[model samples]
Target: MSYTPPSWSPPGQRPPGPGPRSRRDRGLTALAVGLTLLVVAVTGAGWYGYGPGAGDERTRAADAKESAAPESTAPPSTGAASPRPSLRTPRPVRAPSAQELAAARRPGEAAAWIAADPTDLPRRNIRVDGPWTVGGTVVQALYREVTAYRLSDGAEVWNLTLPTPVCEAPEHAAPDGRIVLALASSGSRRGARCDRFQMVDLRTGKAGWTKELLRDPARDTPAIIVHTAISGDTLAVAEGLGAAAFRVSDGSRLFTVPTENPGRCHPDRVAGGSRLLVSATCALGDDPRTRYSQLRALDPRTGAVRWRHRTPAGRRVERVISVDPVVYTSIDNERLTDDWRIVALGPRGELRRTIDPRPKGFEHCVNVGIGAGLQPCPGVVVGHGLVHVGGTDRAGAYDLATGKLLWGVRAHDGRTLTPVGFRSSRGTVVYESATPSRPGRTFVLGEGGAGKEETLMNHPAAAAEAEYSTMAGRVLQAGGRIVVMPSFVTGEDDRRQPRLVSFAPAPE
Candidate 1:
């Protein structure tokens, strides 16, 4: 063992303990050892993971963390954000223009309108066959005659021939695009029987059905009766027998309510809608007298009393306020010393508001001051929030809601005026008119009649007024335009030129 130990030291006089080492390598080694020591010190001082070689270590650790996660092209973010929707603005309705208003103010322009034309003229007989404002597009028996010119201009759209000649302009409806017209023949039937009925498919110039009706030949003759109302596809008819209803669709009889004295009760309908207010009087027997007059709402579909009301024995005078269900009748009972009773009734004929004339408020005092034969005064023009009533002598404003009296002013002298149309737009009350003094004029009043009355675009008095003849006029709103009825030609009933007048405000 002593001989083997001597052999290693004999060749270079150095043991094979340390490998070959240069000065630069020995320096790097010393530097790395020093850096390791420095990193330990820095880590102890809370400066951990921050150093020259430590950065490489951190990068490798970051690479390892990134590789451990699922791969995704999307960049790292806090969270997803939902897209906000865009806001849309609604379009505004356009106001009328001044030129349009001026056009409407013209007499010729108004007659051309579909609805007002058929009723505006003064002709003895009119044949209305068109889509009208009141009845839409349906053939009708107008008071005036129809012509080829009217059809060409789109004024008359249908050719309706009644199965029996309908003397009065029958009520018509275009329900489900089917034209239905109510008709009545006075003596066309055998005997004194008069069948009042409806003809359908009038828009297509075809007749659908004819239902027989019984009405007093005296009260509901062709000259006196003007119109009948239809509601929800049902038409109400007043007959000498009693009151009856027929389905407007098929003209089929639904029901009938016979009066106590079927012959004496002359039935009249309320102004609008499909309800009837019957005034039953006992005129059939020898010592004829008015039996107890009762007002009842007859179903337009079935001849049943939805509601019934009893007034004092006399003449039953009925005036309807709202036609849907509630009915108001002003009965002047001759038995009660001509006491005027304003009775309100529900659709079921229940009493709602009873206004007695003997006691004021609900009843108004009847002021019958006949300076002469009832002179035309400014009529009670009611619409919007204000009630505009005027006569040639005076004009006044009343609140329509509360019936509160408002301001008053004297109007035109020797002139009878009626409000053709009223519009409360742009903080003002505009009154469209047909007056004796001025045949055509528009009165613009300040808000609530604050300012004096100002007349705009007044036309000179027509020559026809000298003969006490006046033009019948009406205003209608349709197709987004204000249309006036055509002015009637004076002194010449043969002149059949009708035109539609229209109006719109000036553009802003």
Candidate 2:
């Protein structure tokens, strides 16, 4: 018999279903319950992907079952217990070494060896480490950590240490690998100051700068800015109150964009070079309570208003900035089905094109997981000429120049998927498949979502638990390689370590 603990539930709240459940629902419910339970303890290396109490539950349950068993002694046997069988301990997963990695490299690889050679493919180095966050802000909680890797052959490289015990997730990394921005909480009881911003070194993991974020006291709850995008050497921070930009090199105040009214806004990306695009969702007036959402582009250098493309007031624009020249996002209102759209903007914030996968009514919501927006969506990466977006139900490739959908495929639910770090030989989209029962697998989705789709990683050891407590995100480096931080679900005192996994593409 297998040992399965009761499912994980939110504090004080019961699991989704009511009372006793059927046999079939038990497994699914267990998986879902475990997902939440494991999420809290799952770290790259913190607890071996299982929380501290995970094995305890199994051991306790096994002991209870054993106690009820009938015992019989062989006739005339000595009054002593039988010796136990030798336990086959699980082996540790070893990552590829730096020397083994460099030996497989090719010549003339552009910008971190990102050009395609195709001869040497799927070189990987896997590691297990503490937990870390991507996209928001990097936090210092015990489980909040990052695992950096090489894309060419999945070689584990570096890891980021959090400042405190809490986490401020990272939205994205700077293109030049000089600075990283994160969202964090001050952990105040009075809610006096909750969210914070941090600028850190990409290579050395040192604090480049830090700032306390606040919102207008007039309306809504005061909150700190969460999302950011780096353009050139500048960083743009967004909040519900307003948006601001800072020099990435020195964290110097570059400019500020005040809000028209005290409303919610978030910075998503630095469009082209001169303009910054933000997702604005705010109130029409303080009275009867009306809301409006739109995409606003501003000059990051000087904080000048460029343009605002208004959309339906009720449908909040989730992310106004994107990897491509245009921004992409999805909307789902009570009165309407879920729809996807991309808004292309010129340097002056002129609307160039609007591509809508209108009325698709996707069953998945962006809120379900990280980077789950109608726009960029999760795992969809946009480069010089193409856009890639993937979800549990489907994955699509599109041409950035024509707003045309190139190709798409169906896949499992994934936490993070982006192009291999930086550049390499082929136009590849690397993605991870995270599930409740299996060790998440990574794939190299090539041009047109083609090439090898589902390649098994054969991670060395079984995760401590079947579920992942924390979120998993990835980054693309210069050489067409892949970097990924695995989900963490363990405690701080486990022998099994956590880490980042890097996979480098083979030479052409």
Candidate 2, overall lDDT?
0.39
Tens-digit lDDT string for candidate 1 (42-101)? 321111110122112222332233234344443422221111111121121122232333
TM-score of candidate 1 on Cα atoms, chains taken together: 0.50
- Segments of candidate 2 deviating more than 4 angstroms: 1-176, 180-192, 195-198, 209-225, 261-275, 282-290, 320-323, 333-376, 383-386, 399-404, 411-478, 487-497, 505-508
Question: What tens-digit string does per-residue lDDT give for candidate 2 at 1-508?
Answer: 0111122122333322223432323443355345434433343211111122212322233233323434323231222112211112322222324453244323321111111111111112111222233332221222334433334433334555554322323344455455544433432212322344566655455566665443334543434323456656766765433567777777777887665543343232233233356655455332212454566666666767767765544554545435336555534322221334555555554556655532221222222222211222334555666655544334455565676665544432332233332133334444443332232334545444434354423221122121121123323333333333432222222213234444333335
State every prediction's TM-score relative to the real structure.
0.50, 0.54
Which 10 consecutive positions of candidate 1 have the poorest summed lDDT?
Answer: 368-377
The residue ranges of model 1 lying beyond 4 angstroms of the native Cα positions read 1-140, 143-165, 170-207, 211-227, 260-279, 282-292, 318-321, 325-410, 413-432, 435-437, 442-447, 450-470, 473-508
- Best-matching candidate per TM-score: 2
